[model samples]
Target: MHKTNFAALALLSAACLTGMSSAATPAQKGFITGTVVNEQGKPLPGVEIDVDNTLSYDSSLITYTDAKGQYRVDVRKLPFTFQVYAKMKLKYGDSTVNVELVPNNPDAVAGLAGGVRDFVFKPKPVTAEDPYGNLGRVFVERGIGEYDVDTAQVQVTLTPVGTLADGSAGKARTFKLLPSGGGPVIPNVMWGKYQVTATLNGKALQIRQRTDGRTPATWGAAYTGGFTRDYNALTPSMFLEVRVPRAGD
Candidate 1:
């Protein structure tokens, strides 16, 4: 017994000299808290909070906002390098998207050391610099490649069906799709239903809303735009497909 004890003691001493420890370093305690609100500053409850450790394979910490639109998640600040980033997970139709929340402070997530990262669903108009930063975008995906019609002579009209999401009245608008240029894009339309129609060479062409995977036979019929909700943008968009009609009444 004495000989075995001495051998173990020598081994422990050797390990100490080699700077090795038998126990893992305890994880540091850290937390992230935030609030989610809408454009009108109204609290948005049930918003999902996702906290991830970038350098480690540790499972992410997930939580949701309370009735007061507040959420808090505890994090394990591991040794060596600990980085915790956070985002808001939102559900859109059948898809979910992650939107980055702005950290209250610049290096706030260094160790997940108790920082506030708030998210606000603010819908802004689409600008040249930020085309996708708006309430919604209605795009004519195909005007030239799919058909033999001259895109320069193709005109698409959008007639608003109701009040827009921004509480503003909508107006009918028309745009000429150009083949040589970037396809026609209604970049600044707020989220709402619209009657979409197109004309090629002064002849009305059939239109379809392919955003939600409509049937192939539905392609050659007048289509009312069905926008796809984007959880990240807190808005919706429509990707319209158009085709020339065949011989019939």
Candidate 2:
């Protein structure tokens, strides 16, 4: 009878140990949460959020923020880094946040599961003024005289000087000039030195000219007679600068 009691106790103890082991196993779930805001400190609702694990290209997740601009995501495993992005209206904002996962601190590891935290974005405004404060119209004259106006199309391309990495010389910028009944003129040019080239019907007509901030009249009588009504004598060798607004004001 004593042997029988001892065997029963041993069996009960083994069952209890098996139950404890099962209870101590870690759960397979982790979560994240955060908020998104605009540059004006306003919570942005209905913004789209995308989460991607850096370690796995195929493993990605997507979600949206709630009315309070908050988001949440549940992930099975933790990645070293997760990329988060938000989109509202026509703008897109993105950032990378690190994630930590462990059994003891699962909440800490999965903090802010799939939301953009404190997002702020400001778009740069483009105006008619130049980077400088000078303001005026850009006058372009045809270097080639008296072509059939009905059959001709003019194009101009603008590029910033010293911005090209390939050491290309010529206009820092180029803009295509639309053909008007009288001629082509780019109005309200910002103030900066620019290299200008005029093209007709896909053919390069002249070399680039530098234009300063001064008006067309600054070229004196030579511009008056050559550029007035005559399109052929237009020499494309001048540089021009127009007025533009100051930066960060």
Candidate 3:
């Protein structure tokens, strides 16, 4: 009778252990699926699609689209926000989309099959010229063979080359190139010889120009003196600096 009771207690302990094991198992994983379509509503094949897991500070996950413009990203049960980007070739440009994944809401995912959805992409618009009424203007033309200077392409920065009246070098100013013809304008510059440097990618190219009281009010005025050197050999980070004197100062 004691042996029988010991066996029964051992069986109960085993059952409890099994239950604990089952409870300790991790939750089922979740997935993000989507289709990529172009402006004409056609499935774009060979287009590079990138899915970036934005929820975590590390940005730990990434995936690409398949032949049918379909993509899937499998992740643990945790909720996350993802940034999707589609790029076709080099010149055609790229597009972006944002999505949030929530596995806890059954009703929110009821309509999805395999947690998949369709995404449409459109090209980004060009940036407008600077509207500040500064007296001096700086013009930066996007180099050839480069598309969309605003992001993921090329960046521009501007700085005063000489020293200020206080015998200290002035702070450097940065301006980014836009698809449109206009960019930032440096106004009220004291009339003096100044040099403007254009940095593309990270390389520097110097351009010498004089900014006087006669500087135009339009954004294109920044390019008045034109680049002294050829820009063909310069990289995206290369820069040109223009020298100018303020109108009356």
**How well does model 2 score by local distance difference test?**
0.38
Model 3 misses residue 6 by how many Å?
84
Q: Residue 16 lDDT in model 3?
A: 42
| TM-scores for every predicted model | 0.49, 0.30, 0.31
**Over all chains combined, what TM-score does candidate 3 have?**
0.31
lDDT of all predictions: 0.56, 0.38, 0.37
**What is the Å distance of residue 38 in model 1 from its true position?**
0.6
Residue 160 deviation, candidate 3, in Å?
Answer: 37
Worst-scoring 10-residue span by lDDT in model 2:
97-106
**Over 4 Å off, model 2:** 1-29, 91-116, 123-249
Candidate 3 whole-model C-alpha lDDT, 0 to 1: 0.37
> In candidate 3, what are the lDDT values of residues 49-157, reduced to their tens digit?
4555554465644566677766666644546555545444421012121222211111222111224444444322111332221122334443333343333223334
Candidate 2 TM-score, C-alpha based: 0.30
Residues 51-144, model 2: lDDT tens digits? 6666678676778778876677776456445665555443111212111101111112332333223333322121223211112234455333
Clashing pairs in 1: none
